[model samples]
Target: MINGAHVIIYSQDAEADRAFLRDVLGYPHVDAGHGWLIFKLPPAEVAVHPAEGSGSHELFLMCDDLAETIADLESRGVEFPDPPEEARWGILTTIRLPGGGDLGLYQPHHEPAYDL
Candidate 1:
């Protein structure tokens, strides 16, 4: 039986990124030996969308209110590369990670399946 998912974010500056997640985002985690920290995510859901090619995946952190969430994150020194924009499914924005990568953050207009 399936149990859980482990998500990996490849980083150019891993230590800095780890500190960002730990100190700024405040995601609970355990030290998995040798200073490797594994974060515990909120409830998750998976979806499949048609594409012309394969071997690609995305990660998005969802929130109940995008405006409020953005404000909170900004106060914590999080940077958004762009403002939130509307989509058929949600209002989306990109969070700039300390590792120089972007993570998606969105407030969904469609019902989420994480609770199901």
Candidate 2:
């Protein structure tokens, strides 16, 4: 049987990134060993997208309202690379990570299958 998911975020500044997940985003975590932090994420779902070239899997945070979510995160000092773009699936945007990367965020327009 399947269980919970574990996500690994690679960061240029791993400590700062860990701090962001722990302090900024307020995700509960435990120091496994030697200051290594492991975070617990909220409920999640996965999708498979066809790769046109050399690609990889990704992690995205979904919200009910993109604008409101963006505003709240901005107040917490988070930055976005650009405005949200609308697509058939949702309104999508990139959230700047603490170290030197970005994470995907979206407000889905389709009926959620989270209850499944």
User: What residue runs in model 1 are displaced by over 4 Å at the alpha carbon?
Assistant: none
User: Tens digit of lDDT per residue, candidate 2, span 26-60?
Assistant: 99999999999999887788888889898798988
lDDT string, candidate 1, 1-116, tens digits:
97899999999998988989889988999999988999988778888888886668999999999999999999999999999999999999999999999999999998889876
Model 2 worst lDDT run, 10 consecutive residues:
107-116
Error at 4, model 2, angstroms: 1.7
Backbone Cα, N, C clashes tallied per candidate? 0, 0
- Report the Cα lDDT for residue 28, model 1: 96
- State model 1's lDDT: 0.92
Worst 10 residues of 1 by lDDT: 46-55
